[model samples]
Target: MKYDWVLFDADETLFHFDSFGGMKLMFERFGVNFTRDDYDAYQLVNKPLWVDYQDGKITADELKIIRFEGWATKLGITPFELNSAFLEAMADICTLLPGAKELLDALSGNAKLGIITNGFTELQAIRLERTGLSDYFEHVVISEEVGVAKPDLGIFDHAHQLMGLPCKTKILMVGDNPHSDVLGGINFGIETCWLNTQGVQTPAGIHPHYEVNSLEQLRMTLFA
Candidate 1:
């Protein structure tokens, strides 16, 4: 393998993060039918919170509460309660992305692995354990736990420290987000692979060292 350590972004990179489905399941528990209109409305509030969280303008706690404020008020529940419910629902439905298992299996002995996720602490552990892929990773760094989201170098620095400070050239960060995973790794002086499953245009001047359409392609790129 070309790299000694490989770090990954969790949601949409390795796992299928079906937020709308999770919300629908969560709202069903509250006896509310969450419709597509409701999901669109929710995303209006939720998506920007993620951007803010990633940009370090807001903390994870703030993001969690603010995104659910409207829903909490409508449901007559606290945002904390609603957020917890949503995370649990997400965990219940969590599944690895296509080829995730195969890629991880192939990479296990060749390189040390870690996860650096902007996803909540409530869901990360359970999702890993449930997926039966927990043993492959040497470290799991969560933004909520680290108090810094991706695109900021702090979280990557923290992950590097946990990795015993591997050489920058010998490390690779992989994720679906061009802004966070690609830009962050580039800024941190490490190689990066953007999993551009949707074939979105690369952001201006934020180039990744590599790009692949899927984990299967990544597996081939790395080990073929």
Candidate 2:
């Protein structure tokens, strides 16, 4: 392996982040029939919170509780209760991306593995254990625990410190988001691979060291 430490982004990189589906399932438990229109309405409130979160304008707990504020009001529950319900729903539905298991299996011994996720601390541990992924990783650094999100230097710095500060060239960061994972790694002086699963054009002003269409392709690129 070319790298000593391999760090990954969680949602949409390793696990499927089916927010709509999870919301539907969660609302069903609360006796609400969630529709596509409902999802659109939800995103109007939810999406910006994520941007604010990654930008360090909001704390992880704030984003989690605030996103469900309207729903909590309607359901006669606290926002934290609704958020926990949604996360539980998400955990129940969590699955590895198609090639994620295979790639991790191959890298298990050859490279040290860790997760750097902007995802909620509540959801990550449950899903990792549920999916049998917990043992594969040496560390699971969470924004909620670290007090900083990705694309920020603080979270990456924390992960590096926990890693015993490996040489920048001997570490590789991989994720689906070009902005957070690719740009953050590049700025932090580590090698990076962007997992462009949807084949979208790279957004202007950011570039990753490598790009691949899928985890299988990433696996091949790393080991070929």
Candidate 3:
């Protein structure tokens, strides 16, 4: 393998995070029928909070509680409770993206594997365990635990320390987000690969060591 450590992002990069589907499922238990319009409206609130969370403007707890506040009030529950239910529903529905398991299996013994995700602490353990991918990673670094999100050097520094300070050249960070995953890794002096499954245009002022459309393509690139 070209890299000693292969660090992955949890959502989108490896796992299929169907947020709308998860929300719909969660709301079903509460006797609420969630619709696409409802999801669209929810995103108006939720998306900005995530951007703020990533930018260090708002905290994970703040993002979680605030996003669910409207729904919580309507349901006669706390925002934290709604957040927990949403995360639980997400974990229950979690699945590996196409070719993710195969790609990970191919690299399992050759490289040290780990995850560095901006996702919350609530979903990590259960999602990994349910998917039987918990043993594949050396550590799953969560921004919630680190008190810093991606695109910030602090979180990458924390991940590097947990990795026993591997050479920057020997580490690879892979994720779908250009700003957080690609730019952050580049700034932190490590190689990065953008998993551009959407085939979207790369934004200006950011670059990655590699870019692939799918995990199968990434596996091929690694061994090519």
Give the poorly placed runs of model 1, Cα more than 4 Å off.
Answer: none
RMSD of each: 0.7, 0.7, 0.6
TM-score of model number 3:
0.99
Consecutive 10-residue window with the lowest summed lDDT within model 2: 59-68
Least well predicted 10-residue stretch by lDDT in candidate 3: 202-211
**Which residue pairs clash within candidate 2?**
none
Candidate 3 C-alpha lDDT tens digits along 1-224: 99999999999999999999999999999999999999999999999999999999999989988999999999999999999999999998899999999999999999999999999899999999898898999989999999999999999999999999999999999999999999999999999999999999999988899999999999999999
Stretches of model 3 off by over 4 angstroms after superposition: none
Q: 1-224, model 1: which lDDT tens digit per residue?
A: 99999899999999999999999999999999999999998899889989999999999889989999988998898999999999999999998999999999999999999999998999999999999988999999999999999989999999999999889999999999999999999999999999999998998998899999999999999987
lDDT of 2: 0.94
TM-score of each: 0.98, 0.99, 0.99
Local accuracy by lDDT, each model: 0.94, 0.94, 0.96
